[model samples]
Target chain A: SAVISQKPSRDICQRGTSLTIQCQVDSQVTMMFWYRQQPGQSLTLIATANQGSEATYESGFVIDKFPISRPNLTFSTLTVSNMSPEDSSIYLCSAPLWGTDTQYFGPGTRLTVL
Target chain B: QKEVEQDPGPLSVPEGAIVSLNCTYSNSAFQYFMWYRQYSRKGPELLMYTYSSGNKEDGRFTAQVDKSSKYISLFIRDSQPSDSATYLCAMSAMTSYDKVIFGPGTSLSVIP
Candidate 1:
């Protein structure tokens, strides 16, 4: 198991503003992921962040809207640009346990766009 | 049909009762099955994970996978109030780094 933490545990942002959520892991990992989950809904993968390379985004998400930065193995960031009401959801970061199929998640950053 | 489908049940059960949650998927390519527990305003925590078929038990939680039917289940024995949360079933075709498909999640409430 790994201890993961996210910054700005909860934030309220204005429309058209941008917010960056940070994810820090206790141990170095090969891959980190960003996810968006609406209240009472399932989780949706936004992108895959790998160190030293561009983040691989899912079909509906784009870099222009959700830019990811993986500066190191233990840390990454996800920025929601030009925020709208639709972007008001819980943003979570997760990393899989090394050599195991289990993945651990951060506490999640709850973003509320006004 | 959705790739993954869950009951989405706000199931309420009495403490000490057995609780069962289920999910069905259309993707036979999925080989990894997992159960996650998510409390309100919290990230999901992996409760049980099983590869391929058969059953795996962790404490009071049992996870079962039947590839032929493309269905999976999570059972909790002697449920407690602390177990109240939304249960989500997740699956992946390859490694953990691969894209994981998640179910709609079923909300469970173990009343005291």
Candidate 2:
């Protein structure tokens, strides 16, 4: 099992502002992912953070809006640019343990854009 | 249809009652199944995980998977008020890059 920590557990931001959330893992992991959970909705995959490379984003999400960075195996960050009320959601970072199907999640960063 | 389907139930039950939560999927290739518990304003915590089809028990929680029916369930015995939260079911295919499809969580409230 792996432990993950995310910064800015909850934040309230104004519209058009940007907020960057950070995630750190206790151990080196091969893969890391970013997810968004809107109120009362299921989680949507945002991107896969690869160390030393560009992030692979899922459909309907782009780098310019939700940029990601994986500087190393244990740390990554997601920046929500030009935020809006629609972007009010809980963003979570997850890491899958090597050779396993389970993914451990961080405490999550909740952003509220007003 | 979405790959996974689950009843987003705000199911309420009295303490010590048995609570059942379930999900269904359309992907036949999903070989791994898992259950996650999320408290209000908290990230999801892994409750149980199962590969292939069968039942796995841990303490008061039991997870059952029926691959043939494409159904999975999490049963909580002796439910407690602290157990109130949303339960999410997730699954993935082997060839996938550990990218799992999550179901809309079922909100369960074990009322005292």
Candidate 3:
């Protein structure tokens, strides 16, 4: 299992403002992903942060809204752009360790958009 | 229909009781099954990982997967008050590491 950490354990912001969340893995991982979770709800995949390439986003999510940067294998950042009350959710990052079927997650950044 | 379905339970049980959590899926293609536990204000922590069918036991936790019925379960023996948390069921098709899907999760509280 990899130790994953995210910055700004939580934050509160006004609607239309943007916030960026960072994910850092203790070890190098080949796959890094960003996820969003509403309070008392399931997690939704936002995008796959590819190393040195463009991020792959899931349906219902767009790059312009959740731009991701993967400069290396151990670090990635997800920026929630032009936030809305609907965007109030816990942002998480996860990575599957090499040669393993399990994915480990960061503590998460809880964003509250008022 | 949702790919995966789980009872959003706030099931309360006394400490030391056996707790059963379950999930059913519509997709038979899902090969990797996982159970995750999330405490308040924390991320989902992987508690059990099973591939295909059969039961895997570790300490007080036992994970059972029944591919024939498209159902999976997690049983916690001697449940503790610290076990109070939300449990999520997740799976992936074939060997795709990124094709994972998650259930809404069940909230369990083991009271002392």
Candidate 4:
């Protein structure tokens, strides 16, 4: 297991504003992923943050709405742009540790777009 | 249908009671199965993991995987009030490490 940390543990933002959440891993990871968990809902994959390349987003999500950056193997950032109340959810970052089948998650950012 | 399905259980049980949690998956290609426990206002912590099929036991928790039925289960013996949390099941294929799919969590409350 790796030590994963996320910044801005909880934030209340106005609609139409943007919030950036940062993820840092204690050790380098092979792949990084962003996920969203709505209230009383299952988690949904938002995108895969690839180092030195554009993030690969899942269906119903686009880069313009949730742009991500992975400048290095140990760090990544996700920005929720033009937020809405519907975007009120917990955002998390996770990555697979080397030679392991399990993926570890950060504490997550609780964003409330009011 | 979703790739993984789990009952959104707010199951309440007394302390020392045996607890059962389960998940079913539609994708047979998934090779790695995992169970995670998430407390309120916290990220999920990996509790149990198994590859292929069979049962793995650690401490008071037992994880069972039945690939033939595309089902999996987690059993906790002597449940504690501190064990109350949302339990999530996750899986991944051999194809990539970034495509792990998570099921809807089951909320459990073990009252003392």
Candidate 5:
């Protein structure tokens, strides 16, 4: 099992502004995942960030819109740029314990764009 | 069709009653199955995990997987109000790095 934490539990932001959410893990990991859960929807993968490589984004997500940074093994940040009401959702970060199929998720960061 | 399908139910049950949640998938390659419990406005917490077929029990939670039918279930015995939340079923094929697909969770309310 792993412990994960995210900064800014909940925030209200205006449209067109950007907010960066941070995720930290207790132990080193090769990959970290970012996910978004829109109201009444399932979690959609935003991207997968490695320590030294560019984040791999899923379809419908772009680096310029939802840029991610993984500076080290246990820390990563996702910046939501030029936010809109459509971006209002809960964002979560997860790390799969190496050598296992289990996944650990952090307390999500809820963003509300008005 | 999407890889995974689940009833996004707002199922209500009384305390001490049995609660059952289910999900189905089109992909037979998925070998690992898991259940996650998500509270309102919080990230999902892992509840039960199973590999391949059969049933695994942990306390009041029981996870069952039927790989042949591509179906999975989570049964909560002696449900409590604390069990009120959304239950999401997730699965992966071969590795953790693989694209893990999550079902559209079922919302459950265990009345006190």
Candidate 6:
């Protein structure tokens, strides 16, 4: 099992403003994943952040909207730019256990755009 | 139709009762199935995972997958109030490192 932590557990931001969420893992990991969960909705994959390289985003999500930075194996950041009410959702980060398929998630950052 | 379908149940059951949760998928390519539990204001925790088909048991939890039916289930024995949470069903065609699709999740309340 891996322990992950995210900053700004909950935040209220005005529309058009941007917010960056940080994820830190207790142990080094090669890949970090970002997800979003809207109200009463299932989790949606946003992007995959790989250490020392660019993040690979899923369809319907673009780099200009959700830019990710994975500087090292233990840390990554995601910035939600030009936020809108529709972007208000719980953002979560997760990483798989080393040498295993089991994944562990951090306490998600709840973002509410007003 | 959605790739993954769940009842989105707000199921309530008494303590010590048996609890059953299920999910159905349209993608036959999915070979990995997982159940995740998420408490209020918390991130999801992986409860059980099964590869391909058959049943996998861990403690009081049992996970079953039927590939032919494209269905999976999670059964909890002797439910407790601590078990109150949203249960999500997830699947992947390849590995966990790949994109995994998730269900709408079922909300469960185990009343003591």
True-vs-predicted CA distance for residue B96, candidate 3, Å: 7.3
Off by over 4 Å in 4: B95-97
Per-residue lDDT over B29-68 for candidate 2, one digit per residue giving the tens place of the 0 to 100 score: 9998999999988888889999889999999999999999
Superior candidate under TM-score, 1 versus 2: 1
Model 2: per-residue Cα lDDT over A19-94, one tens digit each = 9999999888878999999999878889999888899999999999999989999999999999999999999999
Task: Point out the higher-scoring one by lDDT: 1 or 5.
Answer: 1
Docking class of 2: medium
TM per model? 0.98, 0.95, 0.97, 0.96, 0.95, 0.98
**RMSD (Å) per prediction:** 0.9, 1.6, 1.2, 1.4, 1.5, 0.9
Instruction: List the lowest-lDDT window of 10 residues for candidate 4 chain A.
Output: A95-104
Alpha carbon lDDT of each predicted model: 0.94, 0.91, 0.92, 0.92, 0.91, 0.94
Task: Name every residue pair that clashes in candidate 6.
Answer: none
| Candidate with the larger DockQ of 3 and 6 | 6
Q: Lowest-lDDT window of 10 residues in candidate 3 chain A?
A: A96-105
Report the error of model 5 at residue A65, Å: 0.9
TM-score for the A chain of candidate 6 = 0.97
lDDT of 1 by residue, A1-114 (tens): 569999989999999999999999999999999999987789999999999999999999999999999999999999999999999999999998676657899999999999
lDDT sort, best first: 6, 1, 3, 4, 5, 2
lDDT of model number 6 = 0.94
Q: Which stretches of candidate 3 lie over 4 Å from their true place?
A: none
For candidate 1, write residues B47-71 as lDDT tens digits: 9989999999999999999999999
TM-score of chain B of each: 0.98, 0.95, 0.96, 0.96, 0.96, 0.98
Docking class of 4: medium
Evaluation by DockQ, superior candidate among 2 and 4 = 4
The superposed Cα distance between candidate 4 and the true structure at residue A64, in angstroms, equals 0.4
Q: What is the DockQ of candidate 1?
A: 0.78
Residue-by-residue lDDT tens digits, candidate 6, A20-94: 999999999998999999998989999999998899999999999999999999999999999999999999999
lDDT of 6 by residue, B22-49 (tens): 9999999999899999999999999998
